[model samples]
Target: MKIAKLAFGLICLAILASNVVTMSRWSEARGVYDDICYLRQAHLFQRLGLGGLNTNAALDYDGYFEGKMKQIAFAEWQDPIRWPCHNPMPSGKDVMQYPPGTGFLLALFPEGHQVAPLYIAASLIVCGLALSGIAMARTLPSLVGAGLFGALAVYLMINPAKASYSVAPTMAVCAVAGFLTALWLTREKRSVLLIALIGLLLGASVNFRLPNALLAAGYAIYLAVAFLRMRTLSAFAQGLGFAAAVLVGMAPTLLAQAVNAGSPLATTYGSADVVAPAFDLAVLGQYVRDMQFVLIVLAIGSTAWLLRVGQGSVRQVALVVAGNLVVNLGFFLSHPIFTPYYIVPIAMLSLWSTSFARLMQPEQVRQAASLGREPTSLGVPSR
Candidate 1:
């Protein structure tokens, strides 16, 4: 068992490094290409002084995205070419249509990296890798659970994408961060402060991609169930704090989307581009196939856990899994644009299962430890 654990861990490490190196090697001449479009969307915020996109800039596409080295990482909206809107756009609506999260990230890119998202994308992926690593190390058991969990996390985090700019890296970061947040927030001595902080983190993630609203829904359910179980007014106050922090994090994009997109929820790409009206049974199968091992393990584990036995944070893990899966499944069922990247939250939450499961006994253990009365007769030291 020890040998197998060592071998498994080493393999996971190699896979992790290989994926990281590949991502590190991307450059402008190679990968950035159109990915920087999000960055330019962010730049519009800076150039136009926090107002909506310039109408003429988007409609008049003359020399807007041009330069030597072809370093034009920008877009002047001609028209938002999404479902329900077919005419050539006469306004700048499309330019500022996307959520400001990715754009805000791009705005932080160095002058050189902006035209190419390679470095930025790689950095975000690395951040995700680091967080997932910490999550597994802190939560999972021994060389097997932790090793397999880390391997699964890296595999999900490193999948190829159309651009690391919007879909890939942003979602990956949010998932990794969200998973870690859940682990911390669900600790035995959970507090209103902790709940608010969790709310703040998950709420902010929603503005990154509108579909992340699904994640928000799941989190809201978890919080609701948790507080309801406690049945206290302070628990409700925690909810308010979470709401305030979310508004703080999303102030820029939320306002911009409302004013520029005409519909606060409408993105630059528009709703039609985000979701397909053609709902089919096959899309569900595609999600299953795309998520691969992660979803399979989750499905199997969930059936057993839900039907047979589980409680405490174990049940919380189930909630996270069910919440993310149910919401995303409904969204992706008809979302023609749904890609593997869209499943980051699902994969991430799935990988986090062990961590949450580890929290099975909270209050009694915490109280015992705090009073310096830990049981040592069995010597089965708890992690």
Candidate 2:
């Protein structure tokens, strides 16, 4: 399976690489905002370490409407620097509101446009690896589902206007991919130790983008519910172990924030005026109404499917999907505007369902053939 997986992975990588190269060379929207700026931020951090935050940082409160503020401003996507006062720009340095993790990630690239292709390809690969991990985790055959996920990820990567790349969606992709990989690791029963390692990595996911907190929480909730169903003391220990691992990972960032800016959640990317106390309740109410309509349909469909397909690991997929639904609900209850990137948590649920669909495939043609003659129809109901 490893050999087959590698072969499939390489083939997929080649296709993606070619696509990225083509996009790089031929696309009219080269060196655009998100494509250039986000990559520039990653490149800056990867090469310069934390010190790079000093270069062209934007205020977080400016929000997303103020337009491209600066190099680092583009990094955090903060249009307005949310500050204690209306004018938060106290010093020459802009707010580095984004977590240090992405800066650290950005550090890995060569500074400037020289390595743009490498940077874009790397992002594409991260996305590909994420999709591949999700497909593989559900015990799905690589030959079938894995390719589609990679292709979809690549397609998504290519189609976005240049501006979209530098903003929230790119970071969201990384978080989505990371969370899916983490969940896959959990499903394999790798170990609490490994899950802890993943939890620490998840800290990066959460710090780079706030929405990742939702994704991480969704996974944690899924595990909690799964353990409850199993009713094992060890399961609780595992959950604690995972949380500890996450905290262990998150500790450094928090400590850094405290030392550098006096708060764990300081806006290095600048700041935002949007306070938890001041959220537009009216807009949030509308969001909730819209989300409710969507979830109702999904719940109805999932319930119908559950009744038709008897109990098994597949049911666990439903539980994971339920966890994701809760994350979306939380988003709706608080944030007024929903972006395309916000759908990331649900994307994991889609991948989970796809994987489960693969796992439940007949062991052999003969087993499937026999099922037709038997009362059951491959464990699905006959309409």
Candidate 3:
């Protein structure tokens, strides 16, 4: 299955255009899920600086109500919903909680931040979508394969049932990119630099959504199994290097957590309120009724992938997919509040894994690099 670069470019553009229009319309109206709060934090970013979302810097601009100020504030949806100051003003219920990844993107504009930076946010999301699209085409050889992959990605974003999580297209795209990055990183031998890069990528995802820390499990397991299989000291060194890099990558988010939640490992939502009983019948029942289609499709597709990619060059891909599913199910089963958007990132990651299996058919074909060649040599016995 081969998609010409031109046709692939057109498809990417179409996806971006659709997302921009949908997000623009949503930005005009009140959204059900949280977005304004992160955009508000972004308004304070330049002045407050990096990792300052939880700091008291916003207090410096309190009551600065000139028309220009009001316009900018209105544009960025800057509410008093931030961590309250000592004077204790009644705040917007919404607060900026996660790392500043999305906030930093939106805060690039100085004035007229515009009912959130829908354009900037949309652009970045579309950019990731394009990156994933290209990666899909490269992994799969045919245009048909690329078209199918694009349809899957677009459907995750456009499906009506998944719309509640539309506030976070960035996370979905990031999940796809993270999957692709893992596939590329593990396609051959690991180096200190490449291992560090993997850490950086996973860390970026964690900063976006803390639970993504689970994605690391797949990598770790793959490393462990590879070391045992090869029984080499270099493999052990590679594993250690990758672990160190993951810590380095996680540092910024940890710093932000310390500032916001007073603990590097804790989230702003760490209170008992959001925790739910394990295997909660009510939440399970709700999900079964509302999310049955998504659950069934992902589970079936992933199972098929597991069967097709049996312990070959794409083992890491399967591990990553399983990790994503575990994290998603873990959260859904345990969380007091599980929304439709919460499952989107997981779905996207699963799609990436499934596509990898489809393209490489790891059960039948392990495309390994030959000496001085470009790695597409299937059944070369080099992996």
Candidate 1 residue pairs that clash: 58-76, 58-77, 79-89, 97-267, 97-268, 98-268
Candidate 3 ranges beyond 4 A from true positions: 1-12, 28-33, 56-61, 64-96, 110-142, 158-182, 228-231, 270-277, 291-296, 309-311, 357-383
* Model 3 Cα lDDT, one tens digit per residue, 1-383: 33465566567667767766765565423433234444445556765677456633344354422222354345443444423211121231233455656556556755444433445354555356545555555443544554555654554454542343233534454544545544554454446566556666666666556666665666677677778988888778878877887777667778866666567875565243346457667776666666544644665576455545444445456665665566666765666665565555556556655555444433234332212233344332223
For model 1, where is the 10-residue window of minimal lDDT?
79-88
Candidate 2, which segments miss by more than 4 Å at Cα?
Answer: 1-15, 22-48, 51-94, 114-146, 161-190, 226-231, 265-311, 329-334, 345-383
lDDT of the candidates, in the order given:
0.51, 0.48, 0.53
- For model 1, residues 1-383, the per-residue Cα lDDT tens digits are 45565566566667767765765565544424344445455555556545523322343233333331144332522223421222223353334335666656556666445533533353456444434444434332433555565565555445544334555544454545445544544465445665566556555666567666565566666567757876767666766666676666566666665565555554545444655457765765676677544554664465355323433444455565567667765665666654556666554554454343443335554355446555333222232
Best by lDDT: 3
- In candidate 1, how many clashes are counted? 6
Query: What are the candidates' C-alpha RMSDs?
Result: 6.5, 8.2, 6.5
lDDT at residue 152 of model 1 (Cα atoms):
58
TM-score against truth, every candidate: 0.71, 0.61, 0.71
- lDDT for 357 (candidate 1): 47
lDDT of 3: 0.53
For model 3, what is the alpha-carbon lDDT of residue 267? 58
